[model samples]
Target: MDLEKPQADRQRDPEVREPEGCLVVAIRLPVRIIALVVVLPVRMLWDALVVVGRIVRDTVLRPFGRALAWLGKALFVWPLVALWRWVLVPVGRALGWLVKWLVVVPAVWLYRHVLTPAGHATAWVARGIRAALTWIYERLLTPVGHGFRWLTRYLVVVPVVWVYRWVLAPAGRAVAWTVYWTGRVLFVLPVLAVWRWILVPTGRVLAVVGREVWTALGHAWRVTGHLSLAVGRFLGTLFRWVFVEPVRWVYRTVLTPVGHAVRDAVLRPVTEAGRAVGRATRRALTSVRESVRQARYDVRRMLFGEPRERVAMARREPAGGETRTLEKRVRREVSPPTRG
Candidate 1:
């Protein structure tokens, strides 16, 4: 009965076999699809983000790392550096001496000996300055001083004045007159001849031109007189029509009660309306100024606080839930109610 029961159970269970390899593969297919579609891409992106973040962090921290390395090297590796420096000191000195011999020493000698006092342009400039100063003193100062001294001696001193009046003064005047006469005789004859020859013809032409100009001017004066008379008559008629009649009409008509009515109704209301608009605009500007002051105070408070992150969060997060709650709290804290 046990054997029969086992056989019956096996028959009932249909041999009790496991699934085939194809079934296992089919079952894993969706999982593989999910991995390829969702998991693999997410993992790859996560890894890429991690790598990018690492690169960014390294880029940002590289300078600090280099600074720390340099400091460490400076602090701990100084003895090796000192040894190298000591070993190179003689070489450095030799190099420096070579450079001095090659470039600096010759340059200094050339400057000192050839480019200083006896340089070509320098010596020439110095000589020119000295000559100019000497010439100025001799030509300008000495002559001025001698003339003033001679004037003082002749004008103020009694013996010098007597010698000048009797001897030097007359001789100077006679010599000056002779030289002046000689210059006059040399220059005046030719000048007078040229003046008479050229100027006589020029004067004749000028006289003819003057007479023509006078005749034209007389005709122009007659035309101008006639034009002025016509202009005066026209202006008289225009003045009678424009100024006098308009004044008379205004005095007669516009000073009446209807004019007063028009003035009171139209002009006065327009003036009052203009004044009211001006006052309203001024009040609006005053309110805007007060609002700006409050805004500036709020801006100052926000700036002194952590504004960048808050502003970024506010821009990113919509005004709902936690954001609205926070905004309400911030508004309440930043702007209290008026105590009216």
Candidate 2:
């Protein structure tokens, strides 16, 4: 009885819920009616606005835009294009051809015929004048100049030179010889004679006396030289023992150490400083060189842009079958048609 009651309640549950569902429906029916009544007129108005906009665009705007375009093309663009292509281009070409044929041709022909011949004629006249001048120089002026030269040379120069060589030279030589001989005879011979006779004997006696005195002096000098040599040897030995050896010893012991100390203290440091300065200068110069190289590279990049290697790739040719097909097409295109 309980199982039957539960099954019966499940079957009757939907029947019992129908009135609540109908009440909810009854509640939503007026709202749906009010929404439909409001939205239908709004939709109709939107559709009417859309239809009007489409009609305005299709009927007025599209045709007007197309008409404006056509009018612009006809009025401005087409006329200018036609003027350039048909009128201006053809006129310019015709003017160019006319200038070439009329102006340039006539100018060239006139130059070739008249101006060149006139220039040649003028050159021929100039050459004739030059020939006339050359003939005058050769026949008249040159011979006259030569005659004058020969006359001057033979008449004036030869006579003067001959007179100087023969007459003047001989007279001058004779006068010189006479003066020389006169001086020799008057003064030199007597002096020579006096020297030979009196002065020579006197000088000979004086020379003998002087020779004896010289011999004595020479012997005395030899003795003095030997005594002075011995004294000099003693003085030299005394000087060496007293001064030179001590000075040498002092130099070896005291001056040498002092000099070495001074050198180490002053000169070595100075030398090392000089070497360091030189190394620093070399490094600076190397850095400057690198900077300059970089600047040069930058300048080159700025001027010519980066270096690019261009490789030329060979074009791939058509295969044999393709080539044959293309050739057949070309042959068919090029060949004349036959009558069927």
Candidate 3:
């Protein structure tokens, strides 16, 4: 099948066919004859009228239009543009500069020269007043305050402290020492004597009794401990022989064999079956997962209509030769022409 022919046939719709070549020529020749024979003079007359209208428009009306345009520009547009550029802009700039010099410069000068110096003078005057206050305090008030303090200390505080240290303290110490010694002699000495005579003897007897009782208790405790130990050992041995050994023997001889039998008959097979089922389930699930993954890849491939792997493979191929050719072309295009 011819591909271009089929495409051309599709482009030409069946409802609208082109006329034959001879039929087109026949139709066009008559139209041309009629136009030449009947319409030629009228067309010539229309052309003449158009030429006259164009000549009049170019010579007279166009000049008048040009004059009107020039007058409008001179009267309205030029004046406005010139006023804004030359008068308004320059006047605004000049006013800004004048204000800077007249108002700002003088204000800055007054602040720097007059106000600043006045502030400094005022500060100096305040410092002088403070110094005067300090001098008065040091010369007059400080001396008077020191004298009053010295008089108060010597007259009132010093005598009070001295009396407390020497006269009152010694008197109080003597009284306390006298009372303490008197009480010790009157009460404490007799109490000490009574305790030495009565309580010392009773305590010595109690000490001897406690020592004897403690020794006897220690001997009895040792005998009881040995007897208890022997009895406990005998009871433990009897219990082991009577109960524990028999139970151990039963477990070793009977229960162990039964457990082995049950394991071999039931548990092992069940365990193996469960493991086989689990392995089969895992394999089935893995196959299902792989199928799902392949299906998803196929769906994506169908929807997007291109394989990314092929594009990536194409990109990975080296393009060194193409790059060199492109570079040579670019150099030929960009470099300046050499002298012949």
- The lDDT per prediction is 0.73, 0.79, 0.78
Q: Compose the digit string of candidate 3's lDDT tens values, residues 1-340.
A: 1111255675776754443355443444444444344444454455557768999999999999999999999999999999999999999999999999999999999999999999999999999999999999999999999999999999999999999999999999999999999999999999999899999988876665564455444444444445555655787799999999999999999999999999999999999999999999999999999999999999998999767564444564447675446777798899999999
Compose the digit string of candidate 1's lDDT tens values, residues 119-219: 88878999999999999999999999999999988778978778888999889999999999998899988799888999887886666556445544444
Candidate 2, residue 75: the lDDT equals 100
Q: Please tell me which predicted candidate would have the highest lDDT against the true structure.
A: 2
TM-scores for every predicted model: 0.19, 0.26, 0.28
What would the per-residue lDDT of candidate 2 be over residues 47-125, giving only the tens digit for each residue? Answer: 5577689999999999999999999999999999999999999999999999999899999999999999999999999
Model 2 lDDT, residue 266, Cα: 95
Provide the lowest-lDDT 10-residue window in model 1.
1-10
lDDT of prediction 2: 0.79
Error of 1 at 9 (Å): 99
Q: Given candidate 3, what's the lDDT at residue 192? A: 100
TM-score, structure 3 vs. true: 0.28
lDDT of 3 at 207: 63
Model 3 score (lDDT): 0.78
**TM-score of model 1 (CA atoms):** 0.19
**Residue 317 displacement in candidate 3 (angstroms):** 42
